[model samples]
Target chain A: MEQNIIVSVDVVLFTLSEGQLKIVLLRRERDPYAGQLALPGGYIHADKDRDSLASAERVLLNKTGLVSPYLEQLYTFSGGVRDPRGWSLSVAYYALVHESLLVPDAELRFELWPVAAVPDLPFDHNRIVDHAAKRLRDKSTYTSLPCHLLPELFTLTELQQTYEHILGVALDKSVFRRKLPELDFLEAVPDAIRQGKHRPAQLYRLRPDRRLTIFDKTV
Target chain B: MEQNIIVSVDVVLFTLSEGQLKIVLLRRERDPYAGQLALPGGYIHADKDRDSLASAERVLLNKTGLVSPYLEQLYTFSGGVRDPRGWSLSVAYYALVHESLLVPDAELRFELWPVAAVPDLPFDHNRIVDHAAKRLRDKSTYTSLPCHLLPELFTLTELQQTYEHILGVALDKSVFRRKLPELDFLEAVPDAIRQGKHRPAQLYRLRPDRRLTIFDKTV
Candidate 1:
């Protein structure tokens, strides 16, 4: 009575490059939609993978060549018509990394598309990208999720701009800084300062072991 | 080179009974774990099921004989050793309903286990239950998730009590009522009032299509 469903993992690797949110899409080297750029995905190897998470990590590593520091299980998209082969289930995950980590090489074979205007893609990949983008935007309002899109050491102004960019709003600097003490997700690098056009600003990084810090109020 | 992995759905249907959070479990009738009280779960028929959500709703309604309004995709649990029958995947979901809906019948073979002290269940069910309970508790602090455990019409005191019960803390009546205007999820039901020993409290129902409302700050 086995139904023989095809299982796979897809990663929506998101990065903020040039002040715009973008996701990585790799050209499928094999059929269903070969030679077309799609979300980095592949079939789950039940024998080699310890579980679905391991499968997702492996697929991301193989397709993107960068191990993301903040990978989360987004959602599971499944249906019969989503694939031509058979009934398929994509255990989708979303990852956040700085753009500097995605150094393009000769054989990387990947392209980045901004989340606002993702082009038509094969299967239900567009829908999966939309869902992942919405989750990131919604969570960034009250969590320290946007910090993942920034480099390790960043100034307070850069962090606030990251939040504002993801939220699509301008926040009052005083109000944003007021909530930072209680949020308590970032720690200043001792004596580290960035010299910009203005006076030097302290550089802060996410506190150790505080990856996804949720705040009581919106930033 | 098919893995022949088993795909299934498991539901952690929780309800508030006598101020306790409990989940429903059913006795398996077939082999592999016959007569063992486990989560209400079954294999997904790729031919008959539309999608994973449809499969989850079908399994819950068929096994429990009651439809839940607050069913949501909890998480996907998959591995090789969770089940004795080789590699498996279980797309888990969680549902919240009032205890009055669980009407016991002679033919229905099910039991309720309090989440606080769940016993040794079969096939990683205990772990699933723990995950669902944690999600509910954490979301209750910022979202109006616990309100689903109340009847259609309830008093503000009842709503606050429900939150307190799920959060495992005592909330001040004055502070909770102060946040009600900002929460704005409930509407007074047409001047309806409930008579009690001290005074009549106004009856309220959730505002139209306002399920799972998020608050700006903690109550």
Candidate 2:
């Protein structure tokens, strides 16, 4: 029997913009929900791409002129009812990028919608977004995953604020500050400080080798 | 482009035998590694299977007579060089089963090999086994995943030994017993005890409606 599964990759690119979680959505350029807002996705290139990850990278780069530093395979969704053409399977990926990377000069303009208030998307995309957001929230509580939402160098206050926004709970300032050093995933940047109206605060960055770190307990 | 990607599903069915982690492997019946030991896998029936999980369940049932209750979707592996027939992608799944469910009489007899000493397998099956074992071990520390490896009724000592066997560490007996109630995933069976020559010890099972639970700290 011949199999004709429509295999594709969808990316749920998340960023913290103005103290809110946002995801990038693009307008489809072809039929089957054409000109509608959906996640940046495309069919896997069998000849050009090496694998699904390469296909995801190519789709993100082509649809939005931004490259994500942290990308992970979220989950796969499939069924015949998901696609109007035929049976389809999507290997969804969730990526975290700094808001500063989304410049306003891309050839094809994409919209950044708040993850909390996203509209109805085509082809089971809303479900994908919800799954990705839940994953981001769940991992942010126990791992250093939320650090990707901030810029390269940031103050501890800004980092805590980012965590609070994602976790939706205010962590005790003293407890949070005390646990940072024990967690040991951050290091103060030499001679780096943020110039604000108040007294300057020291800036910190993730350790050189700690791309992603896990904690034995919730942070 | 005509996408000729061969999408398939492979299952890493894990069980505990002689206090060692083992996975089920089947001998391929057709060409392209015929008669070689490999993970139970088959092509996705585009017309018959609902999704990747359905395909995995079907493949596991056809290859092995037993059905696994705790099957989870693991990572996906894909590339051109994996399968000799053509470019292929495999959505891998890991399943946990109690040893009692596996009967000796089956149409196509399967072999159980310890995860640590598994010999060379066909079609990236060795890599799949390693990945499944790592996932199971990692989750065993903070989640109620190891409970699936034991029979319906088990003593606390049996459960703790299962954990120690999978984690490859000796946990303090008092500390292990204290954390079980706080985790609240297991409940003492109503007036049940293990028949033994010494004193009859209480038997426990996973709490009703608590299939899988995560803990803030390691159990």
lDDT of 2: 0.84
Error in Å for residue A80 of model 2:
1.4
TM-score of each: 0.93, 0.95
- Alpha carbon lDDT of residue B99, candidate 1? 87
Docking quality (DockQ) for each candidate: 0.45, 0.44
| Runs of candidate 2 exceeding 4 Å displacement | A213-219, B213-219
Residue by residue across A1-219, what tens digits does model 1's lDDT show? 577799988989999888888899988888978888899988888788888888888887877788878788888888798999988898899889999999878878789888888888999999889888888888887777899999999999999988877777899999999999988889999999998899999999998778863111110
Deviation (Å) of B160 in candidate 1: 1.7
Tell me how much of the true interface, by contacts, candidate 1 captures.
0.56
lDDT value, candidate 1, whole model: 0.84
Residue-by-residue lDDT tens digits, candidate 2, B8-125: 9999998988888788888888989999889999988889998888888899887887677788888787778788887788889988889878765658689888887998988888
